[model samples]
Target: MSLYRPHKKGTTPSGYRGTVVARERDFTAPTVQLLNPAGVLRPTPEAEPYLPLVEALPDTTLEQFYRDMAISRRIDIAGANLQRQGQLALWVPSHGQEAAQVGSARAARAQDHIFPSYREHIVGMIRGLDPVNILSLLRGATLGGWNPAENGNFHLYTLVLASQTLHATGYAMGIQFDGSVGTGDPETDAAVLVYYGDGSTSQGDANEALVFASSYQTPQVFFIQNNQWAISVPVSRQSRSPLSLRGSGFGMPGVRIDGNDVLVSYAVTRQSLEEARSGAGPSLIEAVTYRMGAHTTADDPTKYRTDAEVAYWAERDPITRYRTWLEGRGASPAFFDEVDAEAADVAADLRRRALSLTAPTREKIFAHVYSEPHPLMAEELAWLDAYESGFEGGAA
Candidate 1:
């Protein structure tokens, strides 16, 4: 019998003796897709409404989108190389999840806010964040590169896993209170897109964020990148069902997309964000992708995973797949070559900037500790100066 077949009620199977094997029901989830891995346009009937949005995107813009993924991947690879060479303090590789990050980020409007986990550098890049600024955060030069208020509403990368989910929900609630959404003007209305990983789904904060989002019907989208492995633990260890199903339990619609397929990711995120901005409640999107490299520079995948697994994911590299799709769609070879060159140039510049970064001075840390200066901060600075003066160099 098939493992997924239903068991008869009150009847035991031959292998179980007296116990019965529970039925495995198929998942009934709504996934809005526009493109498959082979670059074919086989959209579902439900996805038809969003075709105009997809077709409206210019070919030049699509080429740029390809460039974004390519450059981001190059930067990620360089960062990994730096980590291996003992330059960076730590590096989180978003190797195989570029399509999900880049596509979803591009789908958001300028007014929308984004809350990201630490590995969303690609999203930050799409929001016009300086590459060097992002490096400063990884190198421990600053808490985060730019203020959210001035950086296209993109919040700082939260290292505490799913903590950003609550932050996003709170921001969404504030948006509702301020009457910034459901204004019928897509350009002016605001929404929230918060990103997390499969590992963070197990956190209490993530669950609570979903609860509050549902209760208030906030205009937000919870973007979960289910990269198969949460550090050393496989996703199977976290839950038996897909992560998107968690949204159903919270009374919200959920979607699953091929995260490695950039077109699908962009199309689905665009639809979801538009729905949220147009008075719909929160939605959860689970992007099924993989992390082809180690979780972080400090991690050793060899200890917990097999080489065959890494090689398996490598074959499905997001950048490569997207490039193949673009090429198949009559994209010129010259365009591909130009993008490759541009990516290389960007990587070179980033490497130079990272290597030439200067460490902040002693007083620099105290500059932004508080908006207004306080006596306690003055006292602390004075003490730090005295403590440093006691060293052999008598300087910090």
Candidate 2:
């Protein structure tokens, strides 16, 4: 089970010896929540200002959020199955965190650059990535070979934790230096949206990124999907307080929100990204959600997690919770049925394609190690060929 505690009022900030005026999301209110676990539209008072943004969204955009979550859940299940069937080396599950990903990805504009952690398959899809491309990485066919510029600027995933934070901050700084931000032009102003996880917050890279982003006031958003557990380690074991508070400690706004509520995720991220692109500097968002599955296909959640905890989070499953809200908003049953059918088709297609994926030639490894041909690569290629030819029955 995950151990999470909301930051209480008047709790003096600790650890820092400097003049620390803690600027938490709220002194009393809990995380930002709009939809209850039961799919009821009970917005927290702190979320009132963002309701207008949600209300202004077109019907199609709103429904697309639910569709994305549903499809993501399906793709996650398929990926896990593929790993179990020995088609892939590993699979990262993103089941319970769909709302957080879908909402945040949709919030970013086309010109915005997105730096993602490895588990953000849904986010990549939202940014125009083919889901099959994600499977290719686990299958060892390529090293995240997708071109970001051609794929809605969705950068390749970084399996190394928290490194993307620095990459994103640097990119945001470049945007600032290039005069691409705060131009009052909605279409051209670009910001950076980077996703990391709870565990990454403990990394030096993440902290350094936050420091640089704040010092430069970079056009970036540091999105932390606090999924309660970083692998088997409960979040409580990682830090003494809420992760969002790190924003204030770094001179930026920190927000904790109900990550299971797609609406809250969308609204909060949308506003934060707009603030970033407008040159208001960077902010942090900690989405308090749950990881309803193992950390990866190589993990066994039954070893550390509890059934009751899983049940509790399952009750608030992002896809179903958002579906209930969509239904309440007069979304027709036909639309939901269509979404389910499409999800199945997508999963089936991925499975077929994944199975058909052939192993790349040995030479494939030497193809793109360098942007330009290097003497070292040529030497290594020659050695590899000679070594292979020396094997029994091998060609000269």
Candidate 3:
């Protein structure tokens, strides 16, 4: 017998008992949280074990985590500048969600695969992708900077919202098939972490992925960075409730962490990933944060959002809060200066690479369009060659 109790002993609830069953189109979900806006740690009973892990990390490590967020923010800003200067076609900024990306990225094991949305450039850096290569892709010089398999399992950024969730699920299924999980070996048991935004929660692909993950018990974590505004649309317009409850509907535990709190984000993601790798199936993390800057260079958030709302979130800047916490712990001023200098150096190098990038040759674009050359491709290539040869300068 099922453990669930009926809403009524022998009849439906009063509101629906005598009426036809009408499907209500609206429902609200609750946001699960382990930390508050303040820097104080406040973990739930279920999340208590993870607290020790966070506390065990040394002060130096915590400072370095802050540095990662700062450096990444600098890179994001520089990329936006590049776009404005016509060095890039477009640029997506992760200005406010740095803690969410860096904390989770640092928590990932070397064997873990990360499927990310386009805003996860910081995560790419954590996975060993050079910042300049990522800039090159944005500048239209390459499809992507590094191969997925070579970059410590960091996959290419998915431009389509929520599509990478299914890819991550499928990859986790392969991991399960290969018996790469549940061997009690942290070094070998692989897990997958997929990143998305709150706006993507409404996508059919995201919901379907949750269904498949629950049914198959894949070792994956769905990391949703709820940055409040989905481009110009406020999250309230998309759903009345929090996004974490979506995981509960699919029969997996859901937790929310302060995405702005690096400590909480790292601790919770680390714990959830470990659980999944140990055969705990999939989990969902709804990270509560804000996007302080425009979604992209092409977007003007001022049209859709109030200046007051933007100012409010600015006061709670993730990098600033972490720096404050580090200062309280006696971090040296020299260390901060060193990190700032290093970030400047990285940004300068990226700018140089972006300006010097050469466009790929015409032939290079067609070379990988197919695995094996087809008759149609041959004919198209011949036509292009003949057409180009008609010009004063023939095809190179």
TM of each candidate vs. truth: 0.90, 0.91, 0.90
Tens digits of per-residue lDDT for model 1 on 291-310? 88789998988899998887
Q: Candidate 2 — what's its lDDT?
A: 0.91
Candidate 2 regions exceeding 4 Å error are 1-29, 390-396
What lDDT score is found at residue 107 in candidate 3?
Answer: 90
Give candidate 3's total backbone clashes. Answer: 2
The most accurate candidate by TM-score is 2
Query: What C-alpha lDDT do the candidate models reach, one value each?
Result: 0.86, 0.91, 0.85
Q: Candidate 3 — worst ten consecutive residues by lDDT sum? A: 28-37
Best by lDDT: 2
Between candidates 1 and 2, the lDDT winner = 2
On residues 1-396, what C-alpha lDDT tens digit does candidate 2 reach at each position?
645554445453442345556676433326998888898888999888888888899999998998898899999989999999999999999989999999999999999999999999999999999888889999999998599999999999899899999999999999999999999899999999999999999999999999999999999999999998889999877777888889999999999999999999999999999999998999999999999999998888899989999999999898888888888989999999999999999999999999998888888879888899899999998999999899997756
lDDT of 2 at 239: 74
